[model samples]
Target: MSIEFIYPEFEVIRNESRCIACRVCERQCANEVHSYDPERGIMVADESKCVNCHRCVALCPTRALKIVKSDCALRENANWPQSTINEIYKQASSGGVLLSSMGNPNPLPVYWDKILINASQVTNPSIDPLREPMETKVCLGKKKQEIRRDENGKLVCEMTPQLELSVPIMFSAMSYGSISYNAHASLARAATELGILYNTGEGGLHEDFYVYGANTIVQVASGRFGVHKDYLEAAAAVEIKMGQGAKPGIGGHLPGAKIVGDVSRTRMIPEGTDAISPAPHHDIYSIEDLRQLVYSLKEATEYKKPVIVKVAAVHNIAAIASGIARSGADIISIDGFRGGTGAAPTRIRNNVGIPIELALASVDQRLREEGIRDNVSLVVGGSIRSSADVVKAVALGADACYIGTAALIALGCHLCRTCHSGKCNWGIATQRPDLVKRLNPDIGSKRLINLVRAWQHEIKELMGGMGINSIEALRGNRLMLRGVGLNEKELQILGISHAGE
Candidate 1:
């Protein structure tokens, strides 16, 4: 055996007493982890290939399979963990950067868990969501700072374009090439049904998804892959993706292997050509340059759609957001370090960017202090896990929240973190025809709708508990939130007092 050989991280245990040798596990796994041993009259597994995605276990009729983490260990060393050792070995052998999917899996402080929401006690009575109306609707765009009146005291009602959402949640970007066609369809349909929006990552929109344009937010990244006149005009909003949370300051890369047929045509790239986006837009070096693109997109859309500037949350995010607000952008979307991606350099994903809670608080406070809070709406996304996170975000000054990983989970993604391999067993993050067919858009869309609807109900309940009826009232209302297990710095940055204060 080679000295660099690393043991499989997972072991597949098959109960021989219940094994029927049906070959169902062999047929279901795209990784080819399971196969029939004809001579032994039994099913066997190549544990080395297993990603622990659970496709085989879920499909087994007899429930005869289970996958568990391997118990093997190296010499105990607190400074160097097994995963770290494994990564070093892999990098030494491959001489390449390590890649990962999904959000950072580090045990960093989750501010959401540390924060607590306040409920009405005595004076301001709580409202019953079941009996009373609770407004979860949100409007994302530049808002009017003051009421305008004509000479005759008549109200002037001119307003810029805005995205009106029934719920303060939108599905975050997941590109067409990065994820399967059915996955995009599911997100589009669900966004339409839920009266929300879904971003079209850096990948260009498919020709068939034009019907969902009203509920779509097409993106223009450094690559400018699928962006064109028609593409800009087709969507309700346009997002200029300056950076992503997972790999901030770095551009995107979609392997040529996944860029087949429609993916190639949609991106306007030749087949089998790697789509590598430049780390920076050649024309955009300053906020002034960003303003030019924002206006150009608005001009292309005939001033009919709002423009959003999306950036990764880094140090000095407040200053960055302030600049974007003044750059003719109608909205600013901040993606924190914990945001999920199809694939990202492991080091960047885990090391770069700040938490969304801190970024949102700082940006909102800075904008308010500068008297420009109304210049643009604030949307935050990194790891918005549940309805409670949504409520906490709104109280911390977000106009709305974006969810990517949660939405994928609703679509049946086991999050094996092998999206770059393009062999997703759940038909989510794959381009294979057979795997893509596994996800029925009908079922996927319904599941997404159910998830958001349930969240909406919970949001209303949360609002009612706080004695707040509308999202407008909850926006930037820091008094309704308090910190529990946080230090003075965290509590200060979050703009909320410690609990029991």
Candidate 2:
């Protein structure tokens, strides 16, 4: 029952006369829109699949690319808008919600680019990463305030066990219901191989993923989706997602249509009804309430896995982080404004929260001021675009970095940001069988490992340049970082001097 309809009224036309064939457009495009065909001797494009990401257009060497809305007209229908009719036609032909994944792919300010990464030269002699011993591994959890020993020289009080990683980079939460089992498998395998952890976002972990439990981070988001005693105890750490950067102050809606069979049973909600997560945690009304949950998790897990309270970075985040520090949370994960989402409302994604660099600097400073910095470890994310950002985060006070978009990119996500539509063509974010099978877990996991491994070396190099070998030295080493083009108040808040000082 396939209905036939023409697609993409808009088409990109590359003028060959002005084309230099530099292949910049091919290299830049994530969609594989523009590809070189040496036999034809000109670049070729798949106009049908193009979502107008404009990567090719932006990188064209000779200003040769232009996207044009097709002027070809159909039978005019004044009753319904042209777009409305076209959408219905498109759906009739393809039968999907225009699904996309990764982040809200909009033209928003990327603070990481605005900020800069420093390398050592004359003032700070650079240690060669090739020869020098660089330590980039980090553990996220509460470190014992004071190690106690008995008068008889026997060790006394115990410290919490942490999720130890070979490097500071980790995979963020992607729920089973939202993503496929294969995708989860890929994450699990990669995490196990990389000696880092992968988060099970909200969705309960299947029995199959238990082999990777030592490297798993179980999350408890607002919906309390599939949360139970066994679920809590099965992971190395637990994360309570208070908010996400892409859609701060707003919860998410996993449409009922996608909830089928196991997904329906696993979530414990009826199929064909909207699976909505409320904005606020029903039990968490204050710091006291937060403490209750943290202790409850501790009680359930026998005080083994550390409890993490994740919040979106927003105004007064420093103050809020101060409260979370006192709330018995062993870790505080901050997601900045640019953090990606599966299906956050477009408006919320663009307008909510603050940048990670600013938020990280402020939260670290505030906690240090209160002398509670060691109470909890910090992990921040929201468009941590590259290894440089990861290095910058560590220098700015984060103990580790959580990467969502970058991980998905390793899984072949193009960052179209239309995830809510649920028709992701790449198969990385969608649940449909035909499309989901497109992603090979073997290849996806390898790419993920590749990304994190590259980042690890770069992070180490940055640490080496700062005359530091261990990541611990750079964790709160604000002196290694100097503010450039920042205002007086910002510089004061970040506790960094202006560059060249």
Root-mean-square deviation of each candidate, in angstroms? 0.9, 7.5
Error of 1 at 216 (Å): 0.3
lDDT of 1 by residue, 68-109 (tens): 999999888999999999999999999999999999989998
Error of 1 at 429 (Å): 0.8
Q: What is the lDDT of residue 446 in candidate 1?
A: 100
TM-score of 1: 0.99
Question: Lowest summed lDDT over 10 consecutive residues: which window, candidate 1?
Answer: 413-422
For residue 423, give model 1's deviation from the true position in Å.
Answer: 1.0
Every candidate's lDDT: 0.95, 0.80
lDDT of 2 by residue, 340-433 (tens): 7777654566666787788999999999889899899999988888888887788789999999888987887766565555555556666777
- TM-score per prediction, in order, is 0.99, 0.82
- Candidate 2, position 332, lDDT: 95
> Model 1 lDDT vs. the true structure?
0.95
